[model samples]
Target: MSSYFSSADLFRIAPLVVLSFGAFCLLLMEVFIKGAWDKARTAGLFTLVAFVSLYYYRGQFFEGSTAFQGLLFTDPYTFFFAALILIGTFITRLLSDERLREEGVGAQAEYFSLLLMCSVGAMIFVAARELIVLFLGLEIMSIALYCLCGSALWSTRSSESALKYFLLGSFSSAVMLFGMSLLYGLSGTLVIPDIASALSSMPAENMGILLVAIGLMLVGFGFKIGLVPFHFWAPDVYQGSPTPITAYMACVVKAAAVAAAIRVMTLLFVHGDLFSVWSDAIWFIAAITMTIGNLSALRQRSVKRMLAYSSIAHAGYMFVAFIAPETGGLSAILFYLVTYTAMTFGAFGITMIVANSFPEKTDADDISNFNGLGFTRPMLGVLMTIFMFSLAGLPPGLAGLLGKFYLFNAAVKANFISIAVIGVLNSAISCYYYLNVLVAMYFRKGEVSPSHPVGMPMAGALGVCAAASIFLGVFPSKLYEIAAYVVTTF
Candidate 1:
């Protein structure tokens, strides 16, 4: 037992330990803060510090390391994802500080602490090489999200959204665990690599185990990805949470989940020789999920709700790429994630500004609110338009064009021409609603009303998102290169 534990292994996993340690320190800081001003400043500062520390340790990725008998694998892939998760959490914390202050949210400190812990969970999730480690990572991420959903206790809608998400999420998690158990039972091992090797040895005999495990794992990740039938909680959760928190959940949380899903599928399904049978099912799911989400989004007046459904649609597009059969598919998915994250964050950041001032009641993000936004808030409207256009896959913006190109390129390479066709068609259909918001902003004329003004801190966050969107779109090659490097690590 003593031999199983060593300081050297601990150093290899220092990134996780550092994040956990940061969470603890932030908790203590929250408790001892002198006042609201001090509390907010301290919270933001702590998040920044943690992020820098994590980035510094990312250099270790070049060497790659694992610990605890290969339970956790800290390769370049893990480092890449860990960096993304940390940055996403840092932005969320910065966005949340001012909002929490204005709302006088109780336990704001706990909120930051949980956010840090959630980051820790997400970082470990990609590093997990063993089934038990993966399960624990999932729970850590889910538990923090559950609390975040209901954190605004005074709002009935918030409470309702949290309850529904908790119930459904817990059920999905149970199914995932059962699947893991079945796989372990059949393979007589809990490590994913071992399970993959075991599956290959008896492809005919292990059919039952493969089917059950694949189905269950799909249900689990499908919930996180917001695919059809599993996406009921997304709209409500997006509508209820504080806007910044909603943005975090939509972009960062969803992205990490998809990344983990890709790794799992590639290892256990594709490498295990199950991809041939399961590819069709994934294709069908992608078609339906994209179609349904786009159709549902067309009817939504609330921008948040529209984006919620749009996220589901985006997930489907990712699935389309997921089924592709090229090494570049991995790189393509990573590229899509990069563009998606920037555009989604920028869109939501603009929405947060609007909501902070207007405080939507019936429809916080209704298209009706944007009638004269072009004149009233020129920069915000323009930024929001850019986001919408990017989402629609239009030109000049990096997200729509290159993102689709990469996915389609991979699809063509894999002989998934028809799947690529449907994906493009979905993009075209999605453009209508995305453009509708722009029409409301620029072409239509109506009264503009403002309740509260946005602060510099919030503006800074929006600016950060906007710059990233354009920068990523303009020079996607750089990001693609990094993604390619990371994907090769596995």
Candidate 2:
């Protein structure tokens, strides 16, 4: 009925287009360029393209525009996540280059290309207002990650991780798609808003089908976000995958999943009789997820595996925001997501650097590997301490502390005092293991000296992350304001 390619649509979709183009260019470089130096240059160029694209769209945060017949919505929420994913990808690429070169996989251009594609997919996933579009985005992101997880060609563990992630990810996607189909069948529409409107007018007898659809959908989202019961794959996958890829999975992937879940749940379920039906279930899941994640992390000797469990627990903390009544729930979740991204990325970056320092040894991810790092590599040691403290919700200008405080406060405001209390207890439980890392770095004695110096790229990435973690904690008002705007706009 109308022209589909308006200038407005082009403006709205520029970031996604640029990312896809960058990925394609990377692939071309891989095929055409025989020199290792050229491949590194190509990867750097791709990262620059991605950063520039995001910067060009910075105006969209204030504009709050929608385009492509409502399939894409560009607002503070979308801009927030889009920028986050792109920045994460850029940082990850920086980390990946050195690691690949060190591990003898530096010549592979496909790795960086796949990483960019994953970022594109994540951006699309967060912006989708239609179910089919959302599914496409999710699969695009997931498939790339599946390849990235197993990209360590020399390691059998990487292959195992890839296979497990692929199978489980496929099953979850199928379950979610089935749920979307059920909802479409019942509501006669694929658009989220349309489904909500249709459900409001439907008869009580259809409640059973709606319930099943919701359950299936939650199961799918739960698996993606690493919530308990659906969380069995996370530790294995995180441990088996490359450290930088693990960072991407823990931060960008989880953030996208949570953003999508919040959008869908808030649109359809948060305001009706449906809210009553599902609130308790979510509350119970949140409680158990926090407890299980914290307790499991306590027994892990491998720092990477410990942080995997820690990611699960942090997901549980984020879920606490879901149970808060409408006013503060979404904003709290968004704020916590931002803080979580910074601290988690910092932790993983530090882990990567530490692993790199121990080039002569296997199992470098073990906590004991960090022994006396405070004395040997004070900067990394201090940065890791900040990340660890933030993750534990410790005070003294740590963003994680402020994030958990806001989350728990929202829970209190919503009258979920018991759930908030359990979340607090879980935060306390998490401190022991998080602090254990710090103790190893500062107190325990190491058998050997540090093997390598921290590279400039890695150091810069860690600095940015650590600073964000602190700056956000000390002055969260601006971000909170943006989060409020995002929630109110939806």
Give me the candidate number with maximum TM-score: 2
Clashes of 2: 0
lDDT of 1 by residue, 1-490 (tens): 3588666566656656766776787688766767654445555665576566656666555634677888987788877787778778777876786667433257776777777777778777778999889988888988888888777778777778778888998999999888999888878899988888877786487687679888998999889878887888889888877677788888888888988888887888874356777788788888898999999999998888999999999988888888874648888888888788878887887776666555544465677877878888888888887788888888656666788789878877888889889998999999999999889888999567764566787677677777776777788888899888888777
Whole-model lDDT values for every prediction: 0.79, 0.86
> Candidate 1's error at 225, in angstroms?
1.4
Model 1 worst lDDT window (10 residues): 97-106
What TM-score against the true fold does each predicted structure earn? 0.95, 0.97
Name the Cα RMSD for model 2: 1.6
Q: Once model 2 is optimally superposed onto the true structure by TM-score, how far is the C-alpha of residue 196 displaced, in angstroms?
A: 0.7
